[model samples]
Target: MSHRPKVIAGVALAALLAGCGEQAATAPSPAASAAAPTSSAAPSAPATPVAAPDLEADPETVATGLDVPWGLAFLPDGTALLAERDTARVLRVRPGARPEQVLTVPGVEARGEGGLLGLAVSPGYEQDRWVYAYYTAAQDNRIVRFRLDGGGAPEVIFDGIAKAGNHNGGRIAFGPDGMLYAGTGDAARTATSQDRDSPNGKILRLTPDGDPAPGNPVAGSPVYSLGHRNVQGLAWDARGRLFATEFGQNRLDEVNQIDPGANYGWPEVEGTGGGSDYKDPLVTWPTDQASPSGAAIVGDTMYVAGLRGERLWAVPLGGGAPRAHFTGEYGRLRTVEVAPDGALWLTTSNTDGRGDLREGDDRVLRFPAG
Candidate 1:
């Protein structure tokens, strides 16, 4: 569960089923929103199919020849800020210019999954010029804030979190509420995913200053939800519904609708199943098919980046479970983000030492959101 290179730890029974079980399962609690439908049964009636437009019949490459681009954040001016995992450098990409190394962060451990991972611009970027990043430090995975101006030093905001070489959860974004939300890996410890006291393997809600949000389930705790493995992606729909993509252990990879105080089965459960206390995944994929990474929501569709699956998946977001749209075209897609132009930009990760790289390995490509 811990993204780092470590061994799995034992699970704590109380935390494992905390607020999840028969009593909570029957009731429609706020936490129930995190459950995903796993049934193979067909719907009673087929809804009118909405045709998806061809965003990119031939997807064109935007940037190329990178070490391993892990995270991407778009500026208001249409340029992009990219994080290269192994290099610990942040590159700026503009429409008609070459990529430029704007900043090189120090103290980043470039082991397995421990490096510069996710990036996000502040909601008040015009005034603050703040950029947030998730990376592995010598002690643990931490979140830091930095000014966009070159040579500005990073100020540590959150620290003392569990870190693994592989499952380090590293996605960070600003919610509509102006609060910062972070998705963390389990740190190779299964019980940590369910521990409210532990920041590992959980979705955290915090203020811009990295303080725990006021309305969290537990006072003074930033944990939004628990029992997650390696949560790589987070997105919000037009209706403000939060969704996340998590890497599975061996059987099922998952996409879940996240709700405050929700508990997702990790060491106890993997895919969808009937449970009174815990929430199920809205969608499940074989681990090989969907090592899902970053996600972006557009209109009624959720576009997810597939790492091992090597494809872009379009999950219909009309309120039910997600179904795969397309599979196996691009190789090792790592990040999927909605650009300011309304197009979806996907970054490839084949060069990240995980998969086989092709002719244009480690590139950023753009596609229309059909």
Candidate 2:
């Protein structure tokens, strides 16, 4: 686990999960409340109709001994890359090999819910060889990209989003449109979620070079949508509909249908205000049972990772209610990605100074789509 050097030495396990390596809630959204809750609500039912997904499978252990793995990305050749939150190291796992350290990111302040957070392999990886990441430093949170070959230093592409010990939103991915999208938190500032001018508490769209993506809701601005508090997951469906999950404050957690220029009620409303001025969540859960983290969409179902709920949730598309999978079986599911081979790749966060870490506490798991 020593990170004294830069290069990761080896590679480990590999399997093509059909479309893997791809890629909320709501309460007052942590924007209305400045204090973090000591405990979440008890597991409860989804607010809408609930039904099972078309596919479900038991998970198989893929890799172990990973300390606080947060982000996962897949290479063109099927190698999976993961990031450790506290260590700031990127590790690679190929097929049937031991997980080896790839490179240690420099200047990551591994404090609270920060450190090395999210990772995204370039869609043009075969040509560009760039890997993007979002992490926290002493002063703020930022996004940077580096060559996958480890030939150059990490270049800062975006910065200035506020950071806090807890609600530092850190999920980043490339949309089907090939634009880079990032989810951010309000940094305990309620006003930021309502501030269209600030990047904090918003879903941002940017070109590959970190400039605001063209056709944004506002001219010359990166903000795609505002009024979000601690969004950790972003995924797109077959129709290119963007979905995001947000951590709620105290009452309701939510899954929202993201639209450009749409204002998702944060400080103004928690779940559904039924007002035309704000977009409402497609699905809502008690903050306890669905502290949603990372997410992936396969077919008509969207798979969401639950942190406080300790379960994987499957939401049927077209506004059906969501159902929980693997309830309480895995401790603190942090991230879920669909593999290229049609399986789901999941990670655990029990060792992130929170949940009880059992044997093989922090590990990577694979669940083939049934």
Candidate 3:
């Protein structure tokens, strides 16, 4: 499909399976190897802002044998924390090292495509010592905050998001404005995408304390934007341009450059041609080629992980056609994040009940972004 000036489209498909496999071996964390900070939530070294990124180098193996690694985040000291979709465990990962269990969230019900999903450290972590999470609970999808040590029960800052076997849009991050942002699915209720009153199928903005952001479109509501099918990936460029990757139902998928209070037509319009009522996507791909999930941006380039497509996509900002990377070389790519050392990190999702599992079924890879 031609991905030129077209508009479009997060999560779908999976089953209730026990996340298997034991934790990988451990190594001293970056902090333990250096000066440990008071909080493990410090932001990683900012990815170098450049005019372009180079991804030609072969990727290096970071770690292997993970149980559906879904959410990937970095700390100021360059170590990583990841969330397993089925295991409900957060792990500490390092380069050429093994993953060690950090803490398992309590009451996480690992339903289809649900469970412990997205992870983000506080923008003010050094002071707040808080790490935020979005996950599937017994009753609904919710967001909570807690420290790594299990210091206290996770404070339920937000709740009542509809849950389902699939389409549980579960990606969360802190925007440049230091406000918490979440992409939610319609929970298979197609009509909710166009409903402003429902949080489903919307990108929501809130204070870290779980209140509606001060400048939300509604005076006291959390709906930053509505009409998304299932948003699974969120990232921002150097200019603070927020972009999201969404899962389309059958025909099209999208990478949208987000605007405040904008409507991304879903259920109403799949790809483009929504007219003035909805904002079109910056790029669109056939569903077969881009079930785009986790997204990370470096310089002027965006890297999106493709789950069913089994590849990584490099999308350039200046009217450049997106190029594919490692197509089918890594099966079912699930998560992508820019590491503190300025490398692109990707996680494979072979063990996520869909792909043909390899010897090292689920793994993480690092590629140069310089």
TM-score: which candidate is best? 3
TM-score per candidate: 0.85, 0.84, 0.86
Candidate 1 residue-wise lDDT, 1-370, digit = tens: 1222112122432343344343121112343453442212101221211334356466668888888999899888878999999999999976557789988888899899889989999978988898989999898998888986754579888887888777898999887667788999988999888666688888888888888776655556677777899899988765567789999999878887776767887877777663856777766778887799999887767778888887777776554445554466667889988877776788988888877878877888876545
Which scores better on TM-score, 1 or 2? 1
In candidate 3, how many Å is residue 285 off? 0.5
**Candidate 2 deviates by what RMSD?**
12.3
Ranking by lDDT: 3, 2, 1
Write the number of the candidate with greater TM-score, choosing between 2 and 3: 3
- Candidate 1 residue runs with Cα over 4 Å from true position: 1-53, 319-326
Considering lDDT, which of the candidate structures 1 and 3 is the better prediction for this target? Answer: 3
Q: Residues 1-370, candidate 2: write the lDDT tens digits.
A: 1111111111110110011010023222222122221112111221211232333555677888888999998887777999999999999975467788889999899888989999998889989989999999887888989986778789888888788888888999988777889999998898888776677888888877787777665546777777788899998766566789999999888887676666776888777763656777767898889899999888757889999999988887644457788788778999998766666788999999889887897989886655
For model 3, the superposed segments whose C-alpha errors exceed 4 Å read: 1-48, 51-54
Alpha-carbon local distance difference test for all models: 0.76, 0.76, 0.78
Summed backbone clashes in each candidate are: 20, 31, 5
For candidate 3, what is the lDDT? 0.78
